[model samples]
Target: MFFTPFFKMLLHKKYILYLRVFTSLVINRTFIPMTRRFLWLLTCCIVLLSACDKRMVTADNPPETNNPTTGAPPISDKKVQAGVQGIVTDANNDPLAGARVVCGDQNTITDQYGAFRFQEVNMTEAAAVVTVQKAGYFNGIRTFRVTAPGRDQFVQVQLLPKTTAGTFDATAGGVVAASNAQFIFVPNQVLDAANKPYKGQATLSYAFINPESNDFADIMPGDLRAVNDKNELVALQSFGMMALELQGATGEKLHPDGTNSVTFRMVIPATLRKTAPAVIPLWHFNESTGLWEQEGSAEKMGDSYVGTVKHFSFWNCDAQFPMVNFKAVFKDDKNNPLAYTAIQLTRNNNSSSYGYTDEAGEVSGLVPANEQVTISVKDQCGKIIFSKNAGPWSTDANAGTFNVSIDPDARLALSGKVTTCDGAAVTKGLVNIQVNGVHYETAIQNGNYATSILRCATGAATVVLNPIDETADKMSTSTFQLAPGNYTRDLQACDVIQVSTISLLLEGQTTTFTSPADSVLFTSYRSDTSTVSIYSLSAAQKTPGGLIRINIQLSGIQTGPSVSRYFTVAMNDGTYFSESLNITITRTGIAGEYLEGTFSGNVQKIPGNTTAPVSGSFKVRIE
Candidate 1:
């Protein structure tokens, strides 16, 4: 079996060399900013320096700890307790939030700066795993061990952008072009927390409309009908990642190069959106006035406005949204109106419903007030897309007409900005706000952008900003609260230079013997027996996150008898907690170079559960 001393000796040498190589390549880790047009094109082409993976982890059985009082409170006679706080940044120095910080079952999210705190962590409870999650970025989870009582720890979470290995296989997924827009999906190679293949069923369908007919956005993608082993026809709005990629000309992705395949990896939030159906939000697109009008909410030609139940009602919107509008232009073979449509209402059971097509070729009516009701629309062939109780239609199927009155607490107004370090306004940045976890994303506009999307008590919601530069792993965040009215504040970027490394000298500066620098993550890991010191060069540190090339110097070595080996020192918090190194190492590289990796995790737990959640993470990457 491989031994620690031998591996350590080898890693010492590898780390030194990586620093020398990357430092000479770029002046700094930051990327040169680009305009939106070019930025979009760059994304469509290729992303640079990606080495990310999405790995999830869940812990039910807590690990055993050797400490006499690993999870015990400090109030006891002998154990002393102390507080901990710090910032967790990626290798690129970006603060990571929602990074799982656990002391047994307790956990917390990092603030804007990746900052966290464990009010009074006991040094005895020193085992932890920090999991990081941000949209468009790679997901990471790492384990660590605690060594002492009452101590503060620093951490780094090095993240790599979401990327695939090499070009995709034909069936993988790609971008598709429609009338005047493009769209793409996330990759579908998802694995569960246990690294097991997620075996769930899925359903998708949509109709093909001729663009010349002025149909809904020309061609649209369909929504999920059902998933899991069950073929139950789930509502399209219920699909999480399964939600239809809506608005072809205005989809979110940059639209990849060729038109072969595309991937999407998100889950729908049917639970949270339980009340967001069109049941109370019927809208009419008016061609004449260039507006969307609400049907029964307003008089035919009296007011050209559409009332939004959950938001500001057209009746109260002043000039923002109208209370009535128009529809019906496309003509079917029967001289009847034919157009794409959807519903966002609920159907009670034990009820039958029916209605006639208006001038707009659409129909509506209350389903019989039964335990379950089926409200459906007719397709071009006069065939049912699927009875409300039948199945979902391909391409699209909006929920039914809205008829309920919205409570006063639903609508809220919000505004914010995207700026640089110096406070200069930035136009190309994207900010996504999560209120009570409801998402409202917007950009700063051609010149600027902001919206009044309502949010709930999260007290203040989290604001995440993305740079227009495709290569930067930087993301900015802030927290704020809002009531029923207007609120404004400035948002800042918190993403840091987690691995802002640069070599100092010329070529041939590589060496042997991993140094502290090579071990960018100054962390302690725990195991049942002892604490293990992990390195980007060791197995303990290898994660799907970014890799920072660590360089080591050859201290000295003895010759003969010793065989070359490549192993790793990992933080095994599964069974127990121990601070310090239970040292494990490996010898990698054909000639004499090593490049493993590091991941994300918290520092507070490693010390003890007595403390709150510590704010710290680690980044592992290679040059």
Candidate 2:
């Protein structure tokens, strides 16, 4: 048997190409397109095909003398070969076994080493999907194209770990009912799905309602945070949530039921006089019933006392009841030492007759019954720049201290220029001589300018200063980083920024201004306030196996009263998010103090106040 020259070229290359060869039958001559050296491969195909059909082909070299009755032989005489190898792992890098590997109907299971092999298989025609499965872990599926024959069988496929369902119950004496404290919850709600239980860090929020309208009027000064299972720190609202220190493991969970422990900050109620009349309600999350219910009223818990003790209030009262002396401490977010700036204590939104802060930032006032109060902090402009309201509080039998925090209107302090030299600020742009890593950016404004960077992380920032008018000219640049404390810098007044001549050092190095005269005094800062997200428990995603439920407590510091409300959260690109949730804030009671509380109500079928809950979810993105 023999082969023609045309069939040899197509078989050697990686592709299964066909060649058209011409032949003259009458003259008994075939004109092949290729040379004899290339026909060597077709020569072999003819030899093999001759065993099946002798007349199909003829080759340049004659077959063994014993068998020679053949024309040109056929193609496709043998099989193509390749090897398949890969590794299997879990999402956390744990080795996986029993994974099924298959190619062309040939299959094998992964050994203890998570390695598999499928030998002697044809791979030229198609691809296959290798699937790994375990009873408690999420299944892993990967596709591989059987492109060529090989001996290596080591590819890697990682399966996501499965999460076990857990529960959160308030009955263990750990989950507390909201007293008078307003909640200022932490913003992170991401449950680590890689572990058995989903764990997250959140802030607690408490609020107070107006007796007449039941709307938000005040809140606490600081909120407590539980990070891991141990270290705890009180955080200031609108402060950088970035450096928030935690007290505990903040163990994870996929749902409410999966949580084993949680942390919150509660408040002690103000002291009540013998003649005062008021009712305080305490609220807690009912994990079993999927609702929020009162732990017990202040009266029912025996927390109320009608006897007269030295009042914390500094002033003398008209009634025979003792005047208790009380003090209020003020601190900024980040839990740092700060001067309690002057503030106005507004009564029912009317500022004409309210009390003002004393020398120590304390407001001395008297309340006959339970009260929800507001302390509005003033800025240099003499305007009420930041004001927070507490949820609700009823005076009890004792007096100690009440905290009033002034939350700034905008937690952001910006001093950077509006634009850079390039089209916009890019990675490592330069202003003057510094390079800053920017974390926050506003939406693209007009074609000329951009919004200031808001809630940016801790870092230096540099913006390019391209001239807007000339487009080709470069303007002088500015760069700076904002520290945690109050920043006071003079603003630089300038026209359009030119990009033609500015170069900022972006290598993340340091610069020493040998002479102060050469340094530019640009007043810019980047202190951003972080958000603590509060989410609705109604539609939170359940554990995949339907085993755990999640219950969250909103906790935080407040003024005399808290701003009670609901909140929502969603990922940057997640299609589904949260709806409005209901929050109930009550005054705090002294720790280890038990009260025989009573149920006194202005209980209506509908709570009178419904305001949008404070945005509590913290977000970290580089802008």
Candidate 3:
């Protein structure tokens, strides 16, 4: 009825022709009256238009596009391929690795970066509901649409804590008197077999006598918490074989009535550990017997070990690590104990302790007892002059007396000095060396680094030194091929300007930027005829100070010709609008030589709008 006027307007203009056609199909053209004929045509036109209005379109069944190449008909539905990428983090934005993420049938665990990806997802399937689960955090469930084929859907999932499991406060918990150590556990809320909150109680027990001088300094904060595969929280109280007991009221299990067990994890320091993921039994302290009894073993996860307990008690790790005193004497092939030799002892637990021989060639110290003991002797240059595996620990009371011999010709020594570009000592720098495949990390003492005496290699040995820590961004790699003898090399380390001041003056306004200039990373690529040096520097972003970044690429070294150079600059707003217009390279050098230059450019804020002038200078050593 609403469109009656519209139909009347169309009928008024074209009713005569339509009437003639209808009358012609009947007896004669002039037989029917014009009014009756017009009415009949209107009724038929309204029914035809109403039928067309019934055809509907929706998102699930979209209109199709024709394929032009083969002149094929349009296909309304087609299968699509897609992918999903997401990051799993805690409430604090810290990445959570080992979190399991599931999308339909496909699932993956987050990597160290808290990133996971599901590739080749079939878009034709129902909308995916991604479920993220990790112990100590609430479950994260989100429904996301899969984009078209060859496309990716990126998401960031933050797992919130179900409730606070309270802190492992060493000070308040009375583990140690007035200790500054604290560890907090934000555990995910879980349901027990009775469909109740899995909230249990905890108690810590320890040996009264402290083994170390400072118990608080022995354990780190991050070592106290661990998550199991089922996403359950585990707390640890560790010192030199200290006990941590977790239990529920009465005789209730730590987990649920139906569940097999509750789990806990311990992070062992790499310096004191031999191998990761090794199985160590969990021992319960017997209050009456005054001894520890084995309950079960813990499995390793990377650097930490996860142990499940059927019942809670005063649980401690039974690694059976024995502490013993070693009296070792080193000597050359002849029957004489060598003096002034550095004896290094490594136990199966990977715990290391060392001592130097006295004038009488006797070196006594405490070492871990194991099935096999590794002893190495080295002289000043920091190489292993003598290395061998001694037999197991003796049953006698005095531990053991080791008599070892070293070959005189096997000694090889390497030494170097690490210094800044201005010849200042970088005393806090660290250098990591890789020989064959074994890695040795040494620190710079008084700007000098040295290795102890090393045994001769069977074949050609390759040694590489990588500068790290304070001098990581600065410093060239040093590689050497050696046979034997004492060698000394001086290394000119790269310099990092912790604080750099950059300013932009334009439009009667001065904007200053200060940041820790950690952006300088120098690298080179070489071919038979061409070698190029690339320097990239940028200010740290998203800090209290603003952001500034610059990238420089230079070619043709030592020739002194005007080398082809390109650079880009980014300012506070993260808009890389500053395109290089003119750059001046005043000085250039390689290998401990400094590269000094100035750059000026106009930043195009908008099309045909005002542009800001930017300029800066830098002086950094070439790698």
- Candidate with top lDDT is 3
Output the better candidate (1/3) by lDDT.
3
lDDT of each: 0.28, 0.27, 0.45
As a whole number from 0 to 100, the lDDT of residue 81 in candidate 2 is 46
Tens-place lDDT digits, model 3, residues 1-623: 99778657546533444334433442232433465445433443443234223322223323233111232111112445555665566745556666777764345556454666654344332234466777644455443323234444444565654342232221111111112111111121222334344444432222211222222211111112222222222322233233332223442423212122333434454343444336765655433222244455665444444454433334555344444334555555433344435566655544444444443345554445445778877643335666788747543123334545444345445567888777777768776554432334456788888653334544345666765437445655577776555568677666443334334444445544443424343333322222332333332232334444444455543333343355454555645544544556677664445665655667565434567776665555543
Distance from true location, Cα of 356 in model 1, Å: 31
Candidate order by TM-score, highest to lowest?
Answer: 3, 1, 2
List residue ranges in candidate 1 displaced over 4 A.
1-408, 421-424, 432-441, 451-477, 492-623
lDDT of 2 by residue, 1-623 (tens): 24455356336532132111101111122221244323332332332233223221123322223111133211122334444444455544444555555544344445444545432344431223344555544334332223234322223455443332222221111111233211111112112333222233322221322112201111111111101111111110110000011121353222111112122212222332222223332232211111122222222112221111110000011111111112344434432212213334444423111222221223333322243446555432244555665423344222323342323332233333334434353323222211121112222123223222122233433332221222323233233444322333222223433111111111232122111112111111111122332211111121232211111123232213232232222222332122333333232222111111111111111122332222221111001
**Model 1 residue 355 CA deviation in Å:** 27
TM-score of each: 0.23, 0.20, 0.28
lDDT of 1 at 420: 61
Candidate 2's displacement at residue 268, Å, is 5.4
